[model samples]
Target chain A: MRKMTKIDIITRPGKLEELKEAMYAIGVTGMTVSQVFGCGLQKGHTEVYRGQEYAINLLPKIKIEIVVCEVPVEAVLEAAKKACRTGKIGDGKIFVYPIENAIRIRTGEEGDIAIMDPEDVEK
Target chain B: MRKMTKIDIITRPGKLEELKEAMYAIGVTGMTVSQVFGCGLQKGHTEVYRGQEYAINLLPKIKIEIVVCEVPVEAVLEAAKKACRTGKIGDGKIFVYPIENAIRIRTGEEGDIAIMDPEDVEK
Candidate 1:
């Protein structure tokens, strides 16, 4: 069985479109995208709600998760960094974890095969 | 020193409310919730858009991510499975990953401490 790695990229929400394009360019066809609130080193900012100042620790962010077997992890990291970087504190972070298995619900395809695009399988 | 594991639960969106209640009942406080698309063996379903039938391979899913140390991993899994299972297809999947470290952005806390609730810390 091939080793599978799951990469979680939590970054600015505005970067989603650009990030998707970058991932596509790198042959990452399958990914999970979600909106998330990230509480990080930036310490967050204050917002005025109902004329009252409120310190919001959780800032809105976008998290893109991809489980990869065919694409090198480094390539995905590099592409993501270049696409999302703004040289700022809230630029976000990337996390890498080991995935023991991935199963397709409908077909029960597991591991690398579960995540591979059909075209890639044909190729 | 503690073991931190990240559990990613991707399941039916309808189960979110029940799942959250289950997690909270188990002392889970912090979790990142996001909307995602899952493409698996289910093969997807077709829908009519603008009088044209489109084969939508990707299905909407809710992905809840939690990094835990104080709460037992088994407990979380059990709660999730119970809340999500419907004895049918598209019930979703549960993925476990080893987390090397976790950091709290505001205080830069690490490991198990990063994920602990303030009230828990006091107790």
Candidate 2:
């Protein structure tokens, strides 16, 4: 069983789909995105101009999370970087960590094979 | 300093706002909501037809997370139960764990004072 690497990504909502597809291109489709607020090394926040609430989230950011085998860690992360590039505040951040295991409830497959990207294995 | 307990909540998107208010009523703000897929003690999944994406999320679940002081843990959890009541499969589950410390990077306040609920501390 390969150790799964979880990526924490924050990018604009508009760029979310592109980022998701980029990960898919890297053979990582089983992923999750959450509307999240961040205030880490960057201190992501929102600002108000008019009384109207700008869903633009002065601190608007999307968290793209994917669990992938360690072998493809760098590829997946790099793909995300390229896809979610704004080179500015609110563009987001990516953090990686080890995922001990993953399981597919439908197929009853456990570990990497469960949520494994079919494309990566062939590469 | 009180230990922070993290709560993992899974409920319908429709019930999300209500749940948030419930947690807030219990003096828990500063939480995060994530769209999630679950198949835990209950196998949460989606059904598809017509090849059209249904945002209804047949297995839609919301994760309501709160960092709370130990003393009010029970109260917060109870508030959630009362508010998010479907008594159904997607109603979700709540798990609590200990948080050793919390820091408000902005205020430079460490431990309890940083993210402490003003209402809880007053009581």
Q: lDDT of all the models against the reference?
A: 0.75, 0.59
* Model 1 lDDT per residue over B1-123, tens place: 798888888887888999999999998878998778654421243533234654533567888988889999878877887788775556666666787898889888888888888677768
Off by over 4 Å in 1: A42-57, B1-9, B12-59, B64-94, B98-123
* Best by the DockQ measure: 1
How high is the lDDT of residue B67 in model 2?
79
The lDDT, on a scale of 0 to 1, for candidate 2 is 0.59
lDDT of model 2 at position B102: 81
What's the residue-level lDDT of A111 in candidate 1?
67
Worst 10 residues of 1 chain B by lDDT: B41-50
Q: What are the RMSD figures for all models against the true structure?
A: 7.7, 9.0
The fnat of each candidate, in order, is 0.28, 0.04
For TM-score, the strongest prediction is 1
lDDT of 1 by residue, A12-101 (tens): 888887887788788775677777777643245554323565465477788888888898999999999999998855688999988866
